[model samples]
Target: MAQLRSVPSRSGRGRTLLAATGLVLVAAFAQAPSTALAAGGPVPAAPAADGPQLSYVVNAVPGAVETRAVARAVRAAGGSVVVAYERIGVTVAHSGAPGFAEAMRAVPGVQSAGATRTAPLRASGTTDIGRPQKVDLKQALGQARQVERARGGTAAGGEPLEPLQWDISAIRADRAAKVDDGSRRVTVAVIDTGVDDTHPDLKANFSARQSASCVGGRADTSPGAWRPWDPASDYHGTHVAGTIAAARNGVGVAGVAPGVKVAALKVSEPGTSMFYAESVVCAFVFAADHGVAVTNNSYYVDPWLFNCRGDAGQRAILDAVGRAARYAERRGVVNVAAAGNSAMDLAAPKLKDTSSPDDSTPVSRTVDPATCWDVPTQLPGTVTVAATGAKGLRSYYSNYGLGRIDVAAPGGDSTQVPDLPAKNGNVLSTMPGGEYAYLAGTSMATPHVAGVVALLRSAHPGASPQEIQWLLKLEADNPGCPASDATCTGTRHVNSHYGYGLVDALDAVRR
Candidate 1:
């Protein structure tokens, strides 16, 4: 499952309650808009707390909730239960009662209860703090600043393009060597966290006219259904957008296609880490309905196959994605998605391996046997991207399969290319506020292809999305197999791990 949660520690009193309500509480946690509960199972109960605690998960049951009864029982036992959402679930700030556990356990309809998981108090072993090394704000701003100056002014009114501080020239050279910047203008839709239209690098590329925000529920602030910006997750969307198409001039890290127009859509709400399936679908629909040349999806949905074999919610969302992709195709738009960072082959048939990569043996990926359909990476009409390291080798974390992955690019690697400042490791772009930040994962790889698509569109304005996808795959470079593995998959030609080999910018443009 791709779900992320901040569970409370089970070592304390919470552990006692875990045996009864742990699984139920988790099942009732907040779900994406398109997510449906595992049918036929008992509705899950909300978690309990000892002190003033906040529950991120919200229950979905209609009318009155069980917590109210439990709270009443607790009061009899000299404790109080505070209903949070009131309709379906409640948040108990202080389980204010003597024998809190004993009282709650006796309540009717109460099956189980426990505290959530907790984060480590302090970092001791191997956990890196803050953002990864590659994100460099100064460099990104410097680059953006330079571009802005070159354009004769600052800010959007008459602002010069911001110059990034990173080595975008290297990336440009790498791609240009294979393809002349085919088209100066490319359009990509950012489908993750809502973007900050006011950020420096982002402002220049801000398609204020084409942007929309679904997170705020406004659907479209303008006649077209664009939402207003919410400040919670302020820099995330801008950071991602900057990485793709921040204007290039004298400053900041040059975008893969600096001149490309970005249709900014806020799918993830501000402050919230998780986005709803409905939000994703809405964004996809918006992009498909409009004429976005390419759409980049950097987020992944948590697997729900274990709970529901034929989840209507899951199918609804998948259907939306497929329809949107096909619709985009009709409009000559291409969809690019990130192969998740779980270090597994998304196309693999089942889950088997668990060991990390050994020095002598290649690393392996794990799949959920429970998944009934082809994983999202294998979905039709989308180009699933794999990440490669600085040495141009497949990234240890990149998901692969000749049939699934369509191409590869330099997304940076922490283990193999640790020498490059965290900001530069496998990194090749600008950050928010005109700074540069090194980021890895398929998130970084997807934009490269988006940029390539832009170049292809620029070179051949009339080209269809499928045609561009075909040309890139057709022109990719297959890294030769090692002498020892002559019988390996993709030994002589395109394989799953590397796809059609690495993307050659110059070659793609020339083609």
Candidate 2:
């Protein structure tokens, strides 16, 4: 019997604590069994030494059109590779044969050999029902809740005490004064775990033009695909879509561009390997081909975990993402990607013989993970977004470096306090089945910036992707962090940790 498992819903608060406690301490969590998939495969008799037991990984030849020949090779090698996810163009397996790694590498059309791993699709944490928060003028523009809807009630002490509600109307009004938000519809292609189209806020953002479910073709825009309140595959994309373009309707949370359209593209999920670089490339092609102006991706794979053996498979994927993004850029499409949540550079906690920062003390040094960071995002031609706390400082756990991160966005964690206009508690958006949820990560932050790009595209219809990126970088507000925080000295202009600075919607629009 095949072991099956549902994706785990991680508490955002718990994950923030786990990530911030310390890099050395956090390393253990990275090796923990990924909660992104359902659990019910063949039980492993013994686990691997490094982390959880890894099942077989099948490699497909780069640029090869024959997926069957690749599967046949796996079968001939005594590996039972099944489930060809056309979205990413890879296969999964039960186990590997002796010397299977070497044999797969040698097989024609085979790119490389590795194990199939899962990633967490939902953020972990409970909603702080009693935490005190501050609402800034920017977030209070269009206050939705009158005295009656407040937590306490219409009388004294009845304001909604938890799940901080951001006044999307206020944000919209404030932004509108600076720019025009006409019916200029911008389409964002979300390449991640499928989306929850039934969610009220999200329904407004989804487009009727065309949406496809690569999640075995079983998923649709209906509420049933996501049972109860959540779906078994991935709730990541839905939350992201909501943040980017949840409708402006007064039903739920408002997205950055609530009036814009969202193109749902399922590229990540449980029981599936990440879409190869080629698939990502193809996604860019599809997005541009379909008038998608902005592409949001929140999924990544540890290159080292797959042994970092680059072949045609890797090159094709990289070429697809890079070339396609470039093509999109020329065509006025903006690609927004996560800088990855790993605290350190690509090599991160484990640098083999290389020197790593001492966890006991906050340190700063120049390091480039492009050579080692996960693929697609790290590839050239796109904007890589990092996370920021409520105080306009870089999150302790966000990966940093000038070369890697292009800008910073509000990816709130529990430790984040409500700082003026910025709320670090959580960004609430639509979930599956017409529900609302709170999730945070670089995944969450990418869409925030992507939505901003959409808004920019709306105002400046002919703005090139590179020009928009330059405008974003140039107009970013500098949250003066003096030589304090023990992390670095001097003013952080374009550091990796915080990038140019936080995405100032107000500022971006004014530009």
lDDT to native, each model: 0.47, 0.48
Name the TM-score of candidate 2: 0.63
Among these predictions, the greatest TM-score belongs to 2
lDDT of 1 by residue, 1-511 (tens): 1111000101100000001101111122122222222233222333443443211121222224454444445445443232222222322222323344444445566433322111101111111111334434455455555565665766432212223222233234334523453343567887655565555555666676556764421235354233223332233445456656766544444566666677677654333333333344446556655567777765443222111125433343344334445645676777776664545554556744332111112235443534433323445778877766666666656656546677776665555453222334455444444444555566667667677677677777887777888887877777854454322256446776667767666665565
- Candidate 2: worst-modelled 10 consecutive residues by lDDT: 1-10
Find the candidate with the highest lDDT and give its number.
2
* Model 2 global lDDT (CA atoms, 0 to 1): 0.48
Stretches of model 2 off by over 4 angstroms after superposition: 1-174, 182-184, 215-233, 270-282, 302-331, 345-370, 419-424, 489-492
Quick one: how many clashes does candidate 1 have? 69
RMSD per prediction, one decimal? 12.1, 10.7
Instruction: Give per-residue CA lDDT, model 2, range 1-511, as digits (tens).
Output: 0000001111111111111011000111001111111133322222223332223444453332445555556556555433333323344433324554556668776655543322122222211222222233233433423323453442221122112433232233225423543234678877665577767676656764545433321223343332222253245567677777766555555577766788776543233323333234445555665688888866552212111224333333343344556656666778887765545444344322121111112223333333333444565667777666555566555556545677777665557665322343455556665655555556656777787787777777787888888887776655645456544323558654656766666655665
